[model samples]
Target: MGKSQKKRQMRRHNPVRVPDSHLPKGLEAASSSSSRKEAILPILQKMESVDPAERKWACVAVSNLIQNDPSTRRLLQGKNAVGALINRLSDSEEEVVVEAAGSLRNLCIDGGFDICAEMYNKNILTPLKSFIPKISTTLSEYLENPKTAPENAQKLVYEFADNVITILWCLSETSNKAMNAINQISLVPFLMSFLASRERLPISTVTSAAQCLYVLTDENPPAIEEVRSNAPYSACVLSIVQSREGLPQANGKNKEVADNRGLALQVLCCGILRNVSPIPPPSVAATVDVDRDIVMPTLEPVLSLISLVEASQHAQEHIAKEDAIPALEKLSLKHTPKSDHKTPSGLELERLEHKLRTVQLALEILTGVCATLPEPDFDVQDADGEATDADGDEAHEDEDMDDEPEVDMAPDNEAAVKQQSGSNATIFQTLVAPLLTLIQPTPLSFPPLNGPSPHPPTTSALSAIHVSALECLNNIFLSFRGAKIDAPRADPDSGRRIWDSVWQALGAVGTDIDNPGQERRRATWEIGVGVLWGVAEAHVKVLMQLCDAATDEGVKVKCIGTLECLAQHPGSVDANRVCTYFSQRVPEPLLQAVSALIDIYSDETLPYDTNFRQGRFLDALVGSVEGVRKAVRGIDRKKERELRVRGEEVRDNLVAFIEYRRSLGV
Candidate 1:
């Protein structure tokens, strides 16, 4: 009671001193201010008798005071104030510089713009111009000999750059000379160097640079043109171009390598995507997100990287080819701005569609070129008119280049092993043919998430490629309408024995068989899907093959599992196509079996591969019932009405399934 009474008395006597917004936005900002303007002005004028602590608070008070009231605009007219700020920009006190910048920003408001303009007009730009080169040289020296880089240097660089960018951005429209002066400082070089550093620069710095440039270029073209012509801006552009080629090499870890590669792709995408002048497919285009202010010209160099993949594929450099594909996909992955976290829409979709079309075209080119390679071909090119990896890597066993047909379907018994070795002779015969034919290596990593770290951690590329390939595959599968892809089929001449053999081979590889001499077993799974999406002239037959394999005891269960997972791909065959398959390939017994499975296993863990289809089938069943009402409109009204009632029953059943699963936490 005594402690509570004391606290109540204290609350009655004192309350918060400042209005909420009048308080500085941050810890340092608050600490840098005076308790009052009268107290603040005294500190601003002090040349002596001040502790660093008092000086820090004085800086905050000054910045906050100016921000809170326009009367402080006259501070610029006071030579002492402007000089103090400029000096404090180089202050040993971090708070001092932050506060100085804040105050300066306020001072430069229209009433205060004249004060800064007067300095620039009277040759203040000269000091900034002279000072920047020294700063740049110092920063460069630190980069070259990092030991020489000062403590808090990144902060210094950011402040210095922000000041210059803001000034130029604000003044670019005033006169050509003002713009020219801005260009002479070579701010672009400094900013680019910041960007190129593997070390993460502060977001504040990057943001300031981006905003300043967007304002300068978009609002005042002549200023931007001048800046571009200057050595600094040109150097920045060149650094960006070189960075694409400097993708970090993978270490032994495939996953880590994939991740690092993804980072490279992100940089490239961010760099190139701004130049999205080309168009995209409408539905595909619907997914693009556009918000950042990066302009088209800036995107040009990045787009060139995609062409590099095509060129490398032509040249036969496997590593290069691999790099280019993943890189392109990464760049095309959805990019958004930090200022706003929202998906792309409207015109942005059109822009995305255009970008996607280019990617699609590139995929076609890559697949076609890869498919045309000599049986054991590498996807990269070397400058010296020499080829390597065409015979496959010497580290691995090689097969003769002739005499083979579809995969070996039988188990890898000694005879099956011998058959596989024989088939390997047809090195060009695998499913890589179609994948290499239709899909472009994705350059985008994951969909847009967080931005890069202080340094891009090294293990991102492999994950990027795998995920991108999956997404692209999903999209490609979805794109499969009823149209037949012009792919080669198993020979009808062999009474479909070749067709059966090929599938057997597919099943064989998908099994857990030991093939010590196999070049790649995943090759089997990849090729099957490639044919399904790209060259399936007989969609109904393939559907039957997949269904039979899933149910048949003779086929290994894992093969069925693989097909089940593949079906989840977004681009996997469309739901409409599912109906077509249901009509043609789904037999009455199988439909009944599927329906039975749902009823019996409503709350159980479905068979490994069957889970996906099970859920889909339930939904399909519901749709089928809905179709009853429409079908009975003109004829068979009584049956239509009956089916409509039955449809409601099916829908109700599905609701129960969902509720049941929710209860079990499945």
Candidate 2:
């Protein structure tokens, strides 16, 4: 045969399987080889062809060719392939629609990700979802077709749903729009029917249903009734809670099923809990429930979820570990309203009690576990082998004492400054991008909240999951904790005041220092300290409060005892930096702190019954002034002069406050 004729014949007879690798070795010989479309077009056309049997192989070929590119999938942006797939959903051949629907799934890959920016405005998915019923009806038609094989037709519908999920998982804004699509197109009813059935059920239907619900709830507020996005979430949670039997897939039938049902419940509980907060969160317009409508009856679900997490505890979790301390660190912060009324229903109250017990129990467990972990040896070996060489001249403790090493002043090294640039990755994956996903409370305008987002849209729904993650990070940092505590540009006055406020909270009367579990103030103190340190400044007021607590006749001695301990922390040391910037802030806040302390003395004891500790704190503060004055000579002379004056004023104010408290008859 002529060379050209042989090539043409090869192309016609076996367009697709003709491996390009088999092209003649010479460049010129390959120059005339078939183009990409020339090879695949025939296969694609046949796959979409009306011919019954050829379409099967055609679908197979299409899947293979498009495996490497987005262009092939982009070709079906509208319903170009839908019409044929819908028709083929009823194809007399099982392999036909199976291949067709599977090939169609390739269309979802506009890019590597599940969502696409292009699909948003294109709005093609709306139509696709709209038309599914037509295809489903076609399946129904085939089921009853006397002339056709009904079993193959049934399989076709199921295949179509599966493919649809794969496709949706690849679409743009898949969660938001697909949710509306699921509801509008009646996928919910269909899924519920399957779940309700006793037969060998397709779990794909359930997973897809769950994904849709997750997406819906994630992007939009849930509907108010059982049909809302939360219905699926709640149902999924309930499913795990009630019927957590292992599925066929969990036993290795399918790769998608593992024991995420409990986790799924956890996710659902978070989403639900996030809907409300101690503080009102921002608004989210897309939710079915308005922010105001989103209410927590009490912390009951928080309690229940904690129990659930405990019930289905993973053997490797910190709580389950023998030595780990059970944590009370359920991230309990949420936006609270000004009013302090309890939720009307006992439901929320019960929940709070339950959660309280769960947290308390969890803390005990975690603490127990922590005690088991090996501690770093506390033995501090003598440096320079001084003990080993007893005759060696003792290294002068004063050596280079006058010349302190230069502190790193770079922004990154300073804890206070680092806050500006550090990446605060949260326990919640959602937190990395939009506030709606943040574990923190959504701002009033975030998600442009209405009333408030169904949940606070706040810190990724206070799940034990995220709390554990953050705590793990905390423990890690605490283990090898670096970074200098000293920092420039930190507002020492503000820091000092915050510190003093914290101290007052901790030292206040009726304070249950022994029972941290019940101490709301203690919880806040932990959070405040975490935050203050996290932000890299000491709370000034807390220091002053601590000092003032030392003033109480009863608590003065212990307060003095803790003065050294308080100084061990950032404490009023920050007042130095405040003097560096604003000369007045340090004294102003201290005066306030001293005054507050005097007020506490008027009561039975200091805030935390640390009244007897006050005298020691006052003595330390009085004694430290000269050393501080000496420390300030060259450091900040101009600011120090002002502070000295302010100190005198503060002392006078302290005396006045003392008289005022005495008059109050403490």
Candidate 3:
């Protein structure tokens, strides 16, 4: 029969599978029933073999077996596989050392901080440090003249370097001692060497090097100084960000498949630049030059990546909606348990995760870019309660230190640079709208079904993006409010426009209030309060107004909670000292609002329903009152006597309320 006739004839036969079809009849039985330790014990024994080949094979076996299998990792560790691997690092055979380092690196990654710490205690760095000079020499020779090293040898050397540097990177994250050790090894120059020849070295090697530098430089003054002072080092990092030639394109056939490694390199480079930028604004010159080079170029790609990911997410959601099985159809027919084909593959999920991480890194860079250092305190106190001298020495000198008058404007060239180099204000203004879009809840795009449905990749990604954006926005809000970055007189609307966008964005809490993701929603709201706290001098008025007008108890609680945070924090959560600039210099309206809250909570005449529960709210109220009292006490005796008088009344009312609550025991 012809093809059509055969298909019709086949349809007429039984639709079910035959008893002995070609497909596997049953699930595969366990090949071996050995327990975890029993399975790995032999391999551990082989690692100590006098034969180098056996030891190399054993190291490779340990690495392959422990690849993300945490139980296997623990079992191996119990059998002293870590020490075995460290011993192999000093083996006579080069192959053994390479495989050994590879296994240890895998342990650090799979075992996390604890394993890294254990490795450090076991002196993993002692042997790993020995490889640094070798890595530097081999990679240097290969990069300088590829012909000097054979292809296989070059690959092996690069592989060894990748593993060793990665181990150091993992250790550096564990503690200060590990970081100090990595720093002392003069690893920065070697890391810079990788960045300098990124085009020539293996991508994995370059990535490990970048990853090492990214962690090493973070909050490390020594690393930061070395990186910033070396003009060529910074240039190498900047070049990686600037050149987009080798990066994977967004419009490729597999759109979800992102070039995560390349994107990670960019994130590292951005972080390095941020590390060197002197975030608390020690001096304008130090940051301005780096910002000029870093911010604008870095921003364009960051914004573009955000837009790309968002568009991709929308497309995925639309596709998911179209593909969702209809409810009536699902009920009428028998449905099979969701198989692998029905959901995104594991690789696809990984890509989506990486993309989300890239977005987070981008937002963090912006947050760092917007941070401004607080001004220096002229009247500094020593820890021993001794007065400091004019030259900033301490010997119980009771001297009054006069504050320097604020400069209305910087030098013309410096001011020009600030305006052009994406200043904190400019960066804040540019990022606010886009970031606002991230915090709003994403609507449910798939059909609600009784049975388990395919998990969309964007669900967790969206939440992550929201939290990251909220954090970035929180920083921006504080940067502008705390910096008081003055705009020119000719442009009155600049500040107004920024604040308008801020309020409007804060109001865009999405409509999916009762969804299953309410925990994330609550977190979103908590961070929203933090953003408002950033500009509390102005936003507190709005929050109080909301508190008065809103009928929702939750809404009232949030507004009140935000006010309490504002009263305590000097500006943002970062500045939580007893008394500081924004703390001692709180707005008059905030003071009144806090005092009013204390009085309302203290009064017994008001019905219990008129006040919220006296649990966490009471604690927060007491803390806020205490914070205000501390702020008043911290003030110089010569200045601001009115706050002290107000503080005393607030304290008495707070004390009475705690006693009253205790008496009722409610």
Candidate 4:
């Protein structure tokens, strides 16, 4: 056969087809070798199709292309896909609008500053603002006549709102310009109106609106002030939080959904409240009365959650049956022939996570409120008519040393004390009680010091709860100390209970204060300082016990640092009432601990690379000893002499250790 005839026969068997009309207009002839931009340009062209269905398909395709592929995202941006999507947001068809919004939302993901800036420059907000009136009108129509509304309109409305709010959230997170533009459009009021409306919106709608408000108000003071100034807005959020508070705890098919909805509302409300209630300095006069009207009511539901969980756990433990274990094993064996073990279902785990998040939000709100309330004043006066410190200042002062800085231990005036005390008591009852309960650790078996820790470090809801609650307690204690009030006196047995719980949490976490690991150690040390700084002098003995029980060098160092903080702020304790307590009670144990630590530093048999031999540790030890010396100096001559001698000994040991390190050039 001729060569040309043979080629023609081969082509007939396997023909090469050119681009056709079946594919998108510009995309039909594109080959596998086409660049991403080449592939996307045709899709972008198709987005302008006159048919709403075609436009929706085009937008959906664009969204999928950019979802996680950064290269395609860049290609889409180069082809002006964002501008095209923005234009499509106003399409007559609801489906087209939803897809376009989803596409825009995808483009904004991980786009960071550059993409947000691009969107901002392209004026994305204009189209976003236009959706507001349209959504509101459509929602109004749907709510008015649900049965007559367009089929699937309810779902579309929620998707549209969710997408719009998510876009705004992403943009606000990335660009200051976008945030400012959102603020200028009065977005807070617009979003708050949805939340505040009498019409019953979908849970998703309410959640989206709340989330938008949260993102808008985060570190944006004007927006926060806007929400705070709007009384109806604040009331609406409170109502949502309070309304869900009464939701009955039930187990059913849809129970998880209900719990999630409740959690979303609660978290958003807490965020709003936290943003509005700025923590003022202790000296600033309290402007907002958060206790009776807002805080106590807000806390009632949170406390109820705690009680519910405790009750549920208790009931689970006490289920009565003669052969409960064997019956359960037999049933399990029958139900699962292949495996005898069971794990929490996805829904069950999600529900648990939601519960923990709810508790965390509640604790965060309580912390914010406690920060704004005035400190309680617990100082009482003597018969001499002079305003006295909580402890008798005169009895503790030594006349020989005439140059000591005069400590102002007199509490706030009478009326202020009475007013603050009531509010403080309310806070104690509402906030402190639940927090104390949440942070209380269940007993866990731990390995020995030389062995690996049984509980490996992880980020869980319980861990978050512990960290947040400790932070709240720290703030509460600081507030009390600043007000010259004694926490123990205000709530009789509560102080001891709180102290014990804090100690337990500290022990459970097993923080190595010298070589802290992960977030847990940081949180543990924060609680440690809080304990020493807030707990009264009468409980110094308990503080000392923590120091003695600590095995980790880091923990021991933190314990010493806590003592130094107390000594640095001697006026925190009642000098006159606790004069003997400090001079007689505390100095001996404190000195002993210091001496033992100093001996550890001085030990020649220990490895030179040990943390004890480190300069930072020695420096901290010296500072602690010095703090003790200064703390006792004014209380009594005998105690002052004893502390000074011990301080010198500790200093000498630290000096020797430093010299030893220098000799080795370490």
Residue 259 in model 3: lDDT: 48
Name the regions of candidate 4 deviating beyond 4 angstroms. Answer: 1-127, 144-148, 169-178, 214-221, 224-290, 303-352, 375-412, 440-463, 489-497, 506-533, 536-565, 568-666
Worst 10 residues of 3 by lDDT: 1-10
In candidate 2, stretches whose alpha carbon ends up further than 4 angstroms from where it belongs are 1-43, 47-50, 66-95, 106-156, 166-183, 219-237, 246-666
Considering summed lDDT, which 10 consecutive residues are worst modelled in model 4? 10-19
The lDDT, on a scale of 0 to 1, for candidate 4 is 0.54
lDDT of each: 0.37, 0.34, 0.57, 0.54
Per-prediction TM-score to the true structure, in the order listed: 0.29, 0.34, 0.58, 0.53
Candidate scoring better on TM-score of 1 and 3: 3
- lDDT tens digits by residue: candidate 4, 26-123: 32223322334555755777789887766776776675454323445565666678888888877898778887887776566434445656777888
Task: Please rank every candidate by lDDT, starting with the best.
Answer: 3, 4, 1, 2
Per-residue lDDT of model 3, residues 67-153, tens digit only:
424445665666678888898889999988887888887677555566778899989888887878877777777777889978999
Model 3 TM: 0.58
Q: How far is candidate 1 from the true structure (C-alpha RMSD, Å)?
A: 24.3
- Which stretches in model 1 have alpha-carbon errors above 4 Å? 1-37, 47-57, 71-80, 83-102, 109-123, 147-157, 173-177, 198-200, 218-666
Q: Kindly list the per-residue Cα lDDT of model 1 for residues 1-666, writing each as its tens digit.
A: 000011111110001111122233443444344333343446565412245555555454444343323223343234356566556656666555555555554444322234456546555464455556765776677667766656677556556556655555555444556766676655555555555553455544554454344334433445444444454443443344334443322221222221222323333333222222122323221133321122122222222323323422322332222221111112211331111111333223222322332333223222222222223113222222233232212233346634666686566566754553443223223323232322222222111122211111101221222222223332232222222221233333332433444454455334432332121234334544454443333333454465665655334233333333333333322221233334222223222323333344453432221332333544445445444334324335375676455444544565565456446533
Error of 4 at 374 (Å): 2.8
TM-score of model 2 (CA atoms)? 0.34
